[model samples]
Target: MKIVIAGGSGFIGGKLVDLLVKNGHEVIILTRSKKTPSKNVSYILWLQEGAVPENELHKVDAFINLAGVSINDGRWTPKHQQQIYNSRMTATDELVRIISAMEVKPSVLINASAIGIYPASYNTVFTEKSAEIASDFLAQTVKDWELKANHVTQFGVRTVFTRFGVVLGREGGALPLMALPYKLFVGGKVGGGKQWVSWVHVEDVVRAIYFALQNDQLQGPVNVTAPTPVTMEEFGKMIGSVLKRPHWLPVPSFAMKLALGRKSKLVLEGQHVLPKVLMANEFIFNFPELKLALEDLL
Candidate 1:
């Protein structure tokens, strides 16, 4: 299969590309910069002036859109928030246009989504079937992003919105920062520590995308979190245990709000998301337990 991935240079995208290539699939990465092509991988310039990426492609089997500004990059100023929203909308719009122009559209489009679409609740467990949507900034961004990506279904392409949870990995995502406090022996509960943290290993995230590509029955929003969801307190202790550090010193919620502003919601609040679709589809998780996942990544 020849797969085209927008924002293929990103954290999760980089790992996904490696997995696809390792599995003997031809991978085309759409990026803003040029990269030297490898044996089973090629990088095509997109989102740049005078670059006709669609013209440089043929019979693309799958299209994965992971393009977006990182919400964790900086404080959520109005300008930064706009950039976050615009980046996803623009990339997805371009993907729709490119797919429309294609003579043979891909079989499936796996758009990167977030579990933030679900409202943050301690007791409420959310799955793909959950219809209650949050009105927060991140949730709204995800909702609109998914709506934009949904346009590809009109082109007869199966669309899957992989709503990712807190992707825990060594290189990127939320692990390093979260583990830093523990490493310094000052990590304990953040905020109330009761807020749920639905985390999945980065490897599981990549594998889930691969599974979505192969499974025809998968469509619409699919939660890409682990089977077990832990509270923030449990998460911190697990990290300490894995790293052999001490989980002490609690950070108050007000301090976090003052420091991170609206971005504080990323840690101070969370949803207990479950991978219902993946489980029903018989997808096996490489690192299902948080302790095991932390040990592997640490």
Candidate 2:
């Protein structure tokens, strides 16, 4: 299939592009760079409110939108927060509008979302069917992001909102930053270490996206996390064990809050999310367990 991917140069998206290319699928990346395209993969420059290449989007097999600002880039100042919200909303809205104008619309529109849509709780395990929406900045941002992507359904296209968790890989996302302290012998649990972290291997994340594209019944919000959800304490232990480091020292809640401000929730708080939709559909995860996932990446 010929797939058009927005933000395909990103960490997870880059891996997905390689996987897609290896699997004999053509990839057209919607990037902001002027980098030359490689074999079976191409690029199209895109910006907010700019002209879209309708010719490239015409009759595409699928449109996978992963464009968004990183929530962990810096402290969540008012301006930073607006950038986070605007980046996702603008990209998704533009995609939906472009796809709507297509003569032969893509069969599927897979939009990247986050599990932040659910309120942070140690006990509650959230699934795709969960109707509860958290009343917070991250939750509302994700809710609005998904709502914008859902607009494609009006044009008879199947829509997918893959709510990602902490995507762990060797190079990018949360693992490297989290592992730095462990390597320096200062690594430990954040806050009280009771917050539940819903995580997944980068490979499994890519697989889930492909699975959603193939499965006709998979629509709406689908959690793209590992089946096993671990607490911050357990997760720290897993990292330490894998890296052969000690996991004892802890970062206090006040220190975290002072450092991250509102973004402290990214580490000090979390949601126990399960890929119930993927499990029901029999989507096998390459690294379902945290220990092995850490070993593979670390």
Candidate 3:
């Protein structure tokens, strides 16, 4: 299959591209960069305002829309908030509009969504069929994002709304950044550490994407997390053990709030999400346990 990834250069998208290519599938990466030369993989330049190149839309067998502004990039200023919304809404609107106009559209449209679509902290288990969107910064952003991507279904296309957890094992993802505190021997739970940390290996994430792509029956919001979801304390211990560092020092919630401001929920709080859709489909995960996943990375 010829796959076109909108944000193929980023963390999860890049990993997916590598796996797709090695699996003997052709890939075309669309970015903000100038046109370059490559084999099997082609590069096309895309921007928020301009139109997608005509041939580029009709050339691929699948379209994976991962283009968006990093929600975790900066402080939650009003301007930054607009950047977060515009980056996702604009890109998704364009992708949906383009695909709707295609003469022979791709069979699948996998738009990247986040587990933030659920309430940040919940005792009740959340599943694909559940609707528990937290009325906060991240939830509102992801909710609107998914709603926009759902528009493609009107055109008779299979739409997969992937709700991702914290992805680990990739070079620059949570592993490297989270390992820093452990390597310094001051790693410990954030806040009280009781918050659940739902996570998955980068490889498993891409695999789930393909599973959704192939399984036309899987539609709507699907949780793309490892079957095992651990608390922040256990997660910190996994990192500490991998780095062989003492994790006794604890960071208080006030410290986190001071540092992260409103975005502290990304770290201090989490959701215990189960990949109900993937598990029901019997999709196998390469790294379901956190220890081996950290070992593979750290």
Candidate 4:
């Protein structure tokens, strides 16, 4: 299989590219910058305004879209919010446009989404089947993002929305930052510590994408989180224990809100998202428990 990946240079996307290449699949990365091509992996610059290169847009086996700005990168100002929206919607809408134009459409289109689409609640467990979309900025952003990606299905393509949680890993994504405070011995719970932190190891994140691509029955939104969800306090404790540090400090919600504004809710509030679709499809997880996930990543 030859796969085209947007945002293939990022943390999780890099891992996914390595996995696909190792599995003997040719990978083409759709990047925003110019880059030299490797043996099996090639690059194509995306302008998002004009048609993608005609030759590269033909007969692709799978198109994995992961283009988006990090919501946690800065405070969610109106400008930053628009950046996030354009980053996701523009990239997705462009892919849909290109793929729709191709005479031979890709078999699968696995697009990225987030569990933040679900309303934040300490008790409610959200699955892909959940109908309650949060009206918050993050949720509305994801809602529109998914709406754009789902449009590809109308063109006879199988589209899968991999709604992610906090992706934990050794090198990148949120784990290193989350573990840094623990390593420095100042790690503790954020907010009230009751907010659920649904997370998955990066290894599973890569594998889950492969699983979704191979399984034809798997369509629609699939939660790419571990089945076992932990609270923010529990997550902190797990990180502390894994790093051999004491979890004593507590980050107040007011302070985070003051510092990060609406972005603070990413740490202060969360939902217990379960991988109902993934598990039902018989997809096995490498790290389902938070402790094991922290141990491997830390």
Among these predictions, the greatest lDDT belongs to 1
Candidate 3 accuracy as TM-score = 0.95
- Alpha-carbon lDDT of model 3: 0.83
Given candidate 3, what's the lDDT at residue 123? 79
Candidate 1 weakest ten by summed lDDT: 68-77
Any runs in candidate 3 off by more than 4 Å, and if so which?
A: 48-51
Q: Write the per-residue lDDT of candidate 2 for residues 109-181, one digit (tens) a residue.
A: 9999999999988888889888999999999999999989998899999999999999998878888988888
* Worst-scoring 10-residue span by lDDT in model 2: 48-57
Cα lDDT, model 2, residue 162: 94
Q: What's the CA error at residue 255 for candidate 1, in Å?
A: 1.1
Give the Cα lDDT of each candidate.
0.94, 0.90, 0.83, 0.88
User: In candidate 3, residue 229 scores what lDDT?
Assistant: 92
User: Which candidate order results from sorting by TM-score in descending order?
Assistant: 1, 2, 4, 3
Please identify which of the two predictions, 2 or 4, would achieve the higher lDDT against the true structure.
2
Whole-model alpha-carbon lDDT for candidate 2: 0.90
lDDT of 1 by residue, 73-165 (tens): 889989999999999999999999999998889999999999999998988989899999999999999999999999999999999999999
Query: In candidate 4, what are the lDDT values of residues 1-298, reduced to their tens digit?
Result: 9899998988889999999999999999987677999989998877645536545666689999988887657788989989999899888988888887788889999999999999999778888889999999889889999999999899889999999999887877778777888888899888999999898999999999999999999999999999999898998998888788999998889988998887888888899999999999889998978888877766
In model 1, which regions exceed 4 Å deviation?
Answer: none
